[model samples]
Structures are given as structure tokens and as C-alpha cells.
Target chain A: MISALQSVPFESVLAGGLLIGFAALLLFAFNGRIAGVCGITFSLIKHHPTLPSMTWRWLFLGGLVAGTLLYHFLTNTPFPEPPNNSLPLLIGGGLLVGYGTSMGSGCTSGHGVCGIARFSTRSITATACFMAAGIVSLFVFKHLFGWSI
Target chain B: MNQKIIALLAGLLFGAGLAASGMNDSNVVQGFLDVSGDWNPSLMFVMAAALMVTIPGFQYFLRRKPIFAQGFQLPSLKSIDRQLVIGAIIFGAGWGLVGLCPGPAIAALGYLNWEGVVFVLAMLAGAKLRQVQTT
Candidate 1:
């Protein structure tokens, strides 16, 4: 396994970080929406017709893919291929991520980025829990089970 | 009308940033999660830089009303309850295991990977499961 710490992708990551920040800022300034992917996607999919039309949600999601492609086109750099191929693992992980985000009322974008920006107490607490859980889970998976998926 | 275009632009920028930041890499994300292993601190820098920009940017836009919308859809709940903690724990565990949170998972679709497609479909199904508990 390559050590990410040693060969850190410093430049691209920072560039991406600024872009992410700018995106969140734009959404806030323009739409008054939390740039939380889970929230945005779910609201578009799981809501009733009486609610506001999901026109923007679809466009935003579409733009997400378009933007990446545009980046590839302009920079002549493409995203790497998917590493994981396990069906069960993907399904289980997806279910957990979805259910948990719904239950917790947020995901990485909502809590990690936007929440931290607002300094919201709940976001702070939620962020701490999730990060701790990720660490503990990784420790157990790596050390105890000796599994790497 | 304008909001839709802005929303699309935001999404595009977000997707590009996600890819650029290496958040779309499951292995990289899991490495960042591993506290005892070969930990990657790149995510920390990303968040710090993001917040550095967002915090000040948020304040700057505080006075100005939304151009075409009403106001910011900021979270209002102040208290951290059981749901938040337990849900976060579950989410974190899932994230550590697969490193496919919603943003990256959805964006990964652009890569045309089977895993991304499968993950997104299953995530949508999982999102639907939420209604089962309620209804």
C-alpha cells in the first residue's frame, strides 16, 4: 500500500479544497441551500410533489458530473478508476452511509464543511462523533479483523 | 430560473473540487480515516482551507440578501441529541469501511466505475428505506 503521508497530493487537494469552499459559498449566497449532497439528493428523490420542484436539484447533480468532465477536458486530467469491486461491500456500505446520513440529518458536506463553517454546536458534536467512529472503525478493521476492503 | 443555473454551477464546481481534492479515492479516504495506520492528513488541510474561505465568505455575505432566493438554509438545531450521535457513528463506520460518502459517491459516477454506480443505487435504496421506518 502506498503511504499517502509520504507522497501527499498537496497541490491538487488544496486546489480542490478552495473549489469546494467556493461552491458552498456560491450555493449559500445564491440558493440559501446547504450544499449537502445527501440532503440535496434526498430532497429531490424522496419528497412529495407538493414540495418545491426538484428542478434545481437535478441540475446541480447533473452539473456536478459535467463540471468534473469539464475539469478533465480543460486540465487534461481524468479521475482514477474505481478500486473496489466487491458487490456486497459496496451495497452494505452504501446502505449504511445513506441510512446514517438520513438519521444523523447530515453527511460529510453538511457537517464536515458547511456545519464547521457556521460553527454550529450540533454540527460540531456530530462531526466529532463521525470522525471518531471512522478512526475506531478503521482501527478495528485494520488491526482486529485484518481486513482491507 | 436563475437559482437553477446557480445550483448547477455550484454542483459542477463541487464535483470538480471533490475530484481535485482526491476525495473521490476510497483508498485515500480510508487512509485519512486510519488514525493508527499510515494516516493521511490531506483531508485536514482541505477542511482547514475550505473553512478558512467559507467562514470569512459566509460573514461577507451575511449582510447582503440572497440575490434570487430568500435566506440561508442554515441548520437550526443547537443541541446534539442521541440521533445525531448514533447516526454519526454509523455514518462514520460506513465511511471508514468504504470511503464513499454521498458527495464522492455521486461524483464518482463520472468515472464510469461499476462500484460507483452500484454504490449510488444502493444508497438511493437506503435513502428510500428511511421512509419505511416513518410510514
Candidate 2:
């Protein structure tokens, strides 16, 4: 476990967190919006009645793709190979994520970061539930069944 | 126009953060989840640091009206209902299986792979199905 810690790059992780926080700050300060990716995606597909406009969602998502490409370009970091999981696994997981986030009303970025920051009880509970579920499921699927995900 | 530009910039930063933090990699996330095995504490640090900044920033920002919009748009629902818990658990199971959520899945598109494309499409389809059910 300690050896695993050694491989975990602290510098990049810290930088990434700061960047994410700052990004959320920018959105909240300037645009009065939470930088929740799942919510943003869902709103794009189905317009929310209360929101002002849809263009920002497209631009924000576009920026996500562009930002990733920019990181690889500037840092010359090679993209990790796609997991060896089967197509069905990928589709099934994706479907659950989409449906669950929509039903639950947020994902990690929404509830974990933005909602938690605001001291929202619902977000807090959701975060705990997801974290617990993730741990248990990983324990069952990966450790017990030896599934490589 | 300025709001859109800011949104774009914020997204770029957010995406870069996701890439830099190694959250874009499913294996890294899985490692974090695999506590009984070789546990990785990176995700904890990322969320901790993010909350440090976000909590302060939001506190300050909430005091004033937003520059672009008429007001700050926050979640109004506070109920800890069954749907929220059940949805989160189901989502968590999926996350455990794949180690890719909506954010990372979208960012993974930078790799320009079919898997990312397929996952994203399936995600959208699932969300649509959920919407249909709710409505």
C-alpha cells in the first residue's frame, strides 16, 4: 500500500484539485452556475425550464474535450489505453451512470464538489451513499469475482 | 457572450484538472476504490483540496449577485429521499464497475477512442430513459 502511494503523483493531483476548484469558482462568481458536468450534459439534452440558456453547456462541454487535448499536447502525456473490459460492460456502466445521475440529480462534480461546498445536506448524503456503494461494489466485483475493471 | 466565454474557460480548466489529477483514468479511480487492495488516496486529496477552495469561494460568491445571470442558481431540494439514495447507489455500482463517471467519460473523449464514444452514447441513452420514466 505504501508502495502504491509512492506511484501516486501528489503534485498533479493537487494542481488538478486547485484547477477544478478555481473553475467552479469562476462559474459561480461570473455566471452564477455550479460546474456540475452531469447536470450540464442532461440540461443540454433536455432543457431545464429555469436555466437561462443552453449555449454555455455546449461551450463548457466543448472546453472539456479541448482542455483534455490541450493537456496531452502541452505535457506530451500519452493517453492511457482503454480498459480491457468488454463492450457490454462499458455500455452497462455508462447506462447506469447516466440514469442514476439523472435520477439522483447530480454526480461527483455536482454533489461531491459544488454541493458539498455549499453545505447542502442532500448532496452530502448522496456523496456518502455513492462512496459507500462504490467501495462495496469494487470489493465484490474486483476482489471477489476477480473482475478487471 | 462574456458568460459563455467564462463557462468555456471554466470547463477547460475543469477538464485539464480532471486530466492532471489522473481522474480521467479508470484504473486510478479503481485503485482509490480498492481499499482492501493497493489503496490510492489521490481522489481523497483531490476532493479535499477542491472543497477547501470551493467552500471559501462559494461563501464569498453567494453574498452577491452574479455578473452574468440575475442570481446564483443553487439546488433548492433538500429532501434526502429514496430516489436520491437509490440513484446514487446504482450510480456507484456502475462507477465501481467502470471507474468512469460522466465527467471523466466526457474528458476521455480527448483520447479519441470508440470506447469513450460508446460509453457516452449509452450514458445519454440511459439518462433519456430515466427522464421518460420520471415524466
Candidate 3:
């Protein structure tokens, strides 16, 4: 049983979920932001110089950075090293996501968590696309491209 | 004073949760994506855990009226049209190639992962490209 837990990578998942939920709760409680990555990112870009909700955006973004820093401090855990990947692939992937987020009107957080929770049809549609794209992409890369990152 | 402020606090806690749960780790996420290689079911567990909390949290919120805005703004669209299909295909492709998505990818920044930086830059670019095309 102990060995099973060790092999399962339980700590990371628990920590991740807790932080995500806490962030959602905080956003709802203090800023009422929904913690949707797509919306936040979009707003940052769409209304750049004249940030309409600058304070909340800053605070929300700040909390994201601060929460992680605090967790590391409290747990005394060393941060994990970044995964290895080519620069091109990394850049390309980001571009694709950016495009998708705009087209879909939200990313996983907006659609997956906030959207789904709110039972937003648009979010459901968007999230479905997000997940489907993820699954299909994995298949192509692994089988067709024979690429493993 | 505003609901946006409340949202920011929620986002912070959510980011913290991601860190705490270790979902920010690409390797772990990669493990889930990698069906052939040492399948890691930990992602499922993390998701389940999140759902457990979220389900109740949402229910509680539903019972009460929106404290800030008019009401809970749910997505109204129902059709799984062309945009939905195409977008999903693209998103899945990206996720498959790289085990980073918007949520976990951003959360990864807390760990100071360079890849997170790269992913975010690309993600922003992707978002911008779409905006330009649409406009």
C-alpha cells in the first residue's frame, strides 16, 4: 500500500488540485474573476495599455505567482525542472493554443472549469474541442510523427 | 467593490491549488498523456479530487444568488458546429505534442520552468493570431 502511494505521484496531484480549487474560491470570493486563463490572457492583450480591470488582473496574476512561491516555501520542496522540448515545437504549440483560445473564446480554465461549472453551452463546446484536440494530437504525434516529448 | 476583485482572489487560490497538487509538473501530465509509456493515472485522481470539491462548491454557489452581477452567466450556445470541431482538433494536437495546456502550463511558471515561459509566449501568440484573423 505504501509502495503504491509512492509510485502513484499522489502528492503532486493533491497539491495541484488544492491550489486550483483555492484559486477558484479566492477568485469567486475576492475578485469574482472565474480564474479562467483564456479570459484573463485575452483581456490582458485585447485591452493592453488601458487595462479596464487592472487592479483585479494584477492581483489575480500576482496570486498565481505568489501561491506557488508560498507552497514551495511551506512544503520545503524543490521545484521541478522544466521538461525538455525543442524551441520550435514549444513556440509552435503556444501559437496554436493562442489561436484556439481566441476561436473557442476560452481555454481549459474558462471552458473546462468556469464554463462547465456555469453550464455554459459555449464553454461545453469549447472544452470538448480542447479535450478532443488534445487526445487526437497525442495520437498523431505518437503514432504518425513518432515523436515523444 | 467589484466582482472582478473577487475573481482575482479566486484565481490566486486556484493557481495555488495547482502548485500544491503538483499538477504543474509536466512530467506528471506527460505521464497521463503517454498511454504507452508507464501510464500515470495520477492525473485522473487529481481531476477527481478537483471535481469532488468543485461539485459541492458549485452547488453551494447555485443555491445562493450572485452576490455581484445579475446572475450566473451560463453559456447559451448548444451547437457543436465547425468552429468547435476545428478548434478541438487543433487543441488536442497541441496537447498531444506537448503535454502543456493553458491551466497547468501557466501554473508551471510558479516553479520557474523555462518551458512554461516558452509555452505561455506561444499561447499568447496563438491567442493574438486568432484575434487578428477575426478582426
Best by DockQ: 2
- Model-by-model DockQ, in order: 0.71, 0.77, 0.52
Worst 10 residues of 2 chain A by lDDT: A1-10
The best candidate in terms of lDDT: 2
Q: Report the poorest 10 consecutive residues by lDDT, candidate 1 chain A.
A: A1-10
In Å, residue B49's CA in model 2 sits off its true spot by 1.3
Model 2 stretches with alpha carbons more than 4 Å out: A2-8, A47-52
**Model 1, B1-135: lDDT tens per residue?**
889989999999998898788788887788788768777778877787778778887777767777678777676778889889998988888888788789988888888988889889888888778756766
**If scored against the real structure, what TM-score would every candidate get?**
0.93, 0.95, 0.84
TM-score of decoy 3 = 0.84
RMSD of model 2 against the true structure: 2.0
Instruction: Give lDDT tens digits, candidate 3, residues A1-149.
Output: 12222233577677576556555644543333466776675667873447556666666666667766776788786676576568888887777777766666667666676666656677677766766567666666666787656
Q: Is the docking of candidate 1 incorrect, acceptable, medium or high quality?
A: medium
Candidate order by decreasing TM-score: 2, 1, 3
Native contacts present in candidate 2, fraction: 0.77
On TM-score, the stronger of 1 and 2 is: 2
How far out, in Å, is residue B128 in model 2? 0.6
Score residue A43 of candidate 3 by CA lDDT.
69
DockQ of 1: 0.71
Off by over 4 Å in 1: A1-8, A50-52
